[model samples]
Every structure is written in C-alpha cells, then in structure tokens.
Target: MTINIIDHFNEYFEMVPAISDELKLEVYKLRYQVYCIENLFLNPGHYPDNLEVDDFDPQSVHYLIRHRKSGEYAATTRLILPGTDNPEKLFPLELYCEIDNSGVMQPINREHLGEVSRFCVSKEFKKRKNETHTLAAIGPDQQDYFTSDERRAFPLISLALIACVIKVSHENDIRYLYATMERSLLQFLSALGINFIKIGPQGDYHGPRWPTVIKITDLLDCVAEKKPNIWNFLTNEGSFGQTRPIEKPSKAVRSNSWVGT
Candidate 1:
C-alpha cells in the first residue's frame, strides 16, 4: 500500500507547544501518568500535585501531541536548554551519565547544547500489545479498534513528537541535542530512518539506556534522504527550512565551540 504518511498523520495528530503555564502543566501531568502510573518508572507518591516536573523544566521548552478526534493529549517531550542565568548547570544526561565525547566531531559549547528528555506517550494512545494499564480500554484484538486509515495514523504519535523536537530545536537556534534512550527505541527509530550517533555506554536508568547525540543538520539530512514524507511534515513542505541539504558547521562557528563540559 502506498501510504502518504504525512497526510494520514495530520488528520489525527496536532502538535502544541507547551509555552504557557496551563500547557506546561498538561505536559507534567501526562508525564506523571505515563511514568508513574503506567510504567512505574517513577513513584506516584513523589508527585504530590500529580505533575512530574523537575528543576531543569524552568529553562526547558516542551511540546504535546493531541489526538484530534478525542481532544486528548497523546504524548509529550521537552528540550532542556542551558541555564541562561548561571550557564554552568549541566544537562540531565551529563549530570547522570558519562558521555564519551572523544568521537565527537567538534568541541561542544554549553550554551549551544540542549538536552532532549522527558519523552513519554500516554498509555491509552499507544497501540502496541506489550503495554497495559492504559486509560484507553483497547480490546485484545488491535484490528477491532479503528479503521485502516486510523490504524495507519495511530502509530505516528511518537514520530510526530520527534518532529516537534526537531522543529522546536531549530526555532531556538540549538544545533546540538543530547538524549538518553532505550537501545530498542533507538533501533526502532533507526528502522524508521531517524538515526542518532551513540556516544556513551548503555546504562540502566528506568530501563537500559544509551546516551546519544545528533546535530540538527544531520537529522534533517537523514529525513530528507530516507523519509521524504516525514521531511515534508517536519518542514511544512519546504517552508520550515529543513528542505535544504544540511551544511557542515563552518570553521568560524566550530572555532568558538560552545559545547558544555
């Protein structure tokens, strides 16, 4: 079947920036639900207000994906930028994990680095069989839930979230992004043609996670080459500036290396 991924995807999911207090609260609450209630990755009692927020959130930018038909949030992710006032605070990944930057192509500056973290998909919205205790009472038979088109669109929730991450980082002028993700999830994204370079040893966080990093241009380059439809969606059909082939960092920019220690 020749599926137009972007067209099918747009009919179901919409990305909302968590700019205001209300929207940010929604992101935190959803994180609490997914990480605390569903996944047991965090203790529910730790969040007295039922919002899973942390210190890094103050300087972070967030995004939420909504399932339009149901008017419910499907997933959320955030980019933690360096502290504007202090500028010495480290990213969550750097504080927690030992990132081997030897393989890095350029020296990094703290001001230019942003950490992508707190990614979660609401239990009810996911279609995979292995997960349970979801808000959405999905039946045993996955085929019975929605129409074929809807089925095709359902899985796009996660990808749409990633697209939002790319979009938000570009808007903020952040060129380098660090993330810690399950190796399996990384592999899955690679299967979808989104790849990140592994830079550290896999460690047990909530689960087995590997520290990884990606350049904005590299991400755009991969999408444009491997998944044109996704590239179109990310760039809004070339309007978002991701359509152009990504160029290497110029010598001048590389010289000033703002990569955080």
Candidate 2:
C-alpha cells in the first residue's frame, strides 16, 4: 500500500505554535525530558522545576508536535529571533563557535536573522535498534502508542519541525537562519534536499555539532526544486506557508518577559 506521507503525518500529528504560557510549558517540559533527563546534555538538577529554560527562551519562538491519538507531544523546536534592543547580542552558536566573517552570510541583514535550536523528540517515540535515538530510526514500538503508519511517518517529524521553523520565518519576514546540528543530521537533511552551508568548524558541544547558516529563500528554492513533495507538505499542507503575515509586536511586547515561546 502506498503511504500518502502527508496524510499519515496529519492524521497522527499536529504542529502548533507555543503562543500561550500553557503551550510554552509543553515546550519546556519536553526539552527538559530530552536535554536534561534523557540525554544529559544539560543538568537535570539545574532545572529544579522540571522545566528546561534558559536566556534564549525569552527571545525565541517555539513549536510543538502533538500526537493526536495519544495527546503526547512527540517533538519540539525553537527559532531564536534576533535581538532588537541590542544588535550585538550573540546567538548560541556565535557564543560557542567562531563564525567565518568572509562568506555568503556576511551581507545578511541582522534584523532578519534567527537561530534554529533546542530541537528534541520524546524517548518513548524512539523505537528502533541502533537508531541513534534520532530521526533516522523512528518506527513502530511495542507500546502500541503509535499505529504502523504513524511509525512509518516518524522521520517526517523532523521535516515537519523544519517546516515549522520556515513557517515562523516566512510569517516574520525573516531572511536568514543559523543552526547547529550533528553532521549526521545534516546529511539526513541533505538526503531530503534540505541543505545548509557550514559557517564554522564543528564543535564538541552536545556531541559533534556544526554551525551552519542558510537564507530562507535559498532553503525554499532547494525544497521547491529538489523535493517538491516535501515543499508542498511544508508550505502548503502544514502551518508554515500561511498567507497571513505575522503581526509585528508592539514595543512593550518586545520585552524579555513577553518574548520566548
């Protein structure tokens, strides 16, 4: 049976913006699970409240993917909007790695840049042997929480998260994106025709992560040309390519307290 991957994804999962405090909590809780408890990327004890949060959370937009049947959020990701008050504020990657000054990213407008970070999936959804507990090995699990088709659609979660990032960017009129990802994840994205240019040397933080950047238009172009199905799934079928422009926040809302997911 041919799987309509898009339908499979939509049937089982929904991607939503963390616009409210309740929704934001969902994002924080999931990050705590993946980054703190499960992976030990961050100290679990550091988050005494069981919610993983940091300085960047205050200036980021977040999204969570919920499993419709189980009502469990399976994955989460965030895009850190650039600082408006202080242009010199550093992105997580910039703080950890040396960005190349002489490159395609030099001319990009800072106001239009955002960083993609804090991507994670739940441990229960990781169901394959030797699968690195990442997107590469999402399959049916013994728990019966996911249907066979849902299991098959696991890899799409990563793509869907990227779609969310792109959606947030398009709505906000963002032009550039910075990210730090494992080389394996980068290669996987490449296989799906989502490409990024390395902007700095690989760093050891959270394992081997490469600092990379991409223009929003260039990313869209790559998807449109090399993976039309994915492009349609992201831009047309999902929440990313909505026609409504994101409303500009009022000055009061730009404060750190009002920002974050």
Candidate 3:
C-alpha cells in the first residue's frame, strides 16, 4: 500500500499545508459554509455548530492550495492516517451501515486505511476566473467548466477538494481510502479520475433520498501515477500537512445515525 510522494504536486498551482490557525479556521469556515449552508448530502442534519468538523480532525492532517504567485487559499482537504486518532479509521462507515441496512459496509476494526473528508473551498476564492487555467498541469478532466465564476466554481470546489486530500494521503503512507458520497456525484468523480467501489443499493438517507457509500483507493492510485505537479507540492512542501497530530477528533462527530432501512 505504498504511494509515491512526488505524484501529486501541481505544476501550475502550488500546494501548501494549511497549518496556521487563521488558515485552518478558513478551512473550517469553508466547511461550515458548504456543508451547513449548501446541504450537499441531499438531506439535512442537525449539525448544530454550523462548523463542518467532526472527531476526525484530531487524528487527521489538513492541507490547503494557493495560487503559486498570490498564495491564496483556493481549496482545502484533510487526511486521517490509519490507526492514528481515528476511532473507526474510516469516515462515517459505521454511520453508513446504520443509514442503509440494505448491506454491510464492514465494521471499524480499521486495518490499513485512511479517511478523506470535509473538503471545500471558499465561495469568494472559487469564483475567480484564473483558477480554471491551472487545469492543464493537473491532468485532463476540467469538466468543471465553471462557465461563470458562480456556476463554474461549484464543481471546481469538488475537484480541488479531492486534489487537496490526495496530496495529504501520498505523504502520510496511506493507500486505502473511504467515503460516503452522493450517488449523483459518481459521474463527476469519474471525470477527475477518481475510482470507486459502490457498496450497496439506494435505500434511505433519513428523509428524502439515499446517499451512496463508496471506497476509493483506486482514485488515489491514479492521482499518484498521473499528476506530477500535485505530487511535488505534497513532498517536502511546507505548511498544511505538518500538524501536531492529535489522537482525539478536534470535535465530536454526529451521534445521529444515517437514514433507516
């Protein structure tokens, strides 16, 4: 399960670790904005704090991306190392099983795995036009046309977010990854070269529709093999990835289970 550290550096846009409190807050606030404000899960939850963080924070390393020139925080993602602070060693897998009794998503014995989650970008930074041009160095799918700063930004948010996590995963020696995502997002992930193994059929998401849980180590594999620019930033690049590595989640996770069987 070894990944090449130099594979994820972005030639056009330099990747940096979001280590400062201000930058981390920026990342946290963005999560709050996207998750709480946008409600991307296709269903709503009581996420009381309005902050998109969970217990995973304590055990994960966070990273941010900035334009090579201006050094602005355009995107962000966090990676939870296997057996670090993560109790489950995966993102919400236990919750997923509870949400859809349709099939088993495996228990959290957590062997060799890492969890990628809570990725987002500031709406203000994402709407800028220049962010789109960096695509050439990132490798192929710029499907996030981002025709307008407003419309185009949403999809880039996901792409950059995925890129952000990949950088962290490569450096930490983590090869396997896990996630519970929206079913409709499958097409979008495919365009970014993300590979997924869908676990079960649609069942319920607590209220409206069912969200899917998928495994994605294959996607990380491609990022390492294809994107050299991204890989550069991850190796020896300073700031974001270097954290004090906490074992407890900076905050507690949602105790509420996912939608029912």
Winner by TM-score:
2
Q: Considering every candidate listed, which one attains the maximal lDDT?
A: 2
**What lDDT does candidate 2 reach at residue 149?**
71
Candidate models: Cα lDDT each: 0.72, 0.74, 0.47
Query: Sorted on lDDT, highest at the top, how do the candidates line up?
Result: 2, 1, 3
Question: After superposition, which runs of candidate 2 have C-alpha atoms over 4 Å from their true positions?
Answer: 132-145, 237-261
TM-score of each candidate structure, all chains considered together: 0.84, 0.85, 0.54
Pitting candidate 2 against candidate 3, the one with the higher lDDT is 2
Clashing pairs in 2: 58-260
Better of 1 and 3 by TM-score: 1
Better of 2 and 3 by TM-score: 2
Worst 10 residues of 2 by lDDT: 249-258
lDDT of 1 by residue, 1-261 (tens): 655566567667677888888998999999999889887888999999999988989898898887778979888899988788876787888788777865683676767788888877887666656545432222233544566677667666667777777777777777888888875568667865678888889886666788888887778777778877666656545545654643322232112211110
Roughly what TM-score does model 2 have, to 2 decimal places?
Answer: 0.85
For every model shown, the clashing-pair count is 8, 1, 16
After the best TM-score superposition of candidate 1, give how far the Cα of residue 257 lies from its true spot, in angstroms: 35
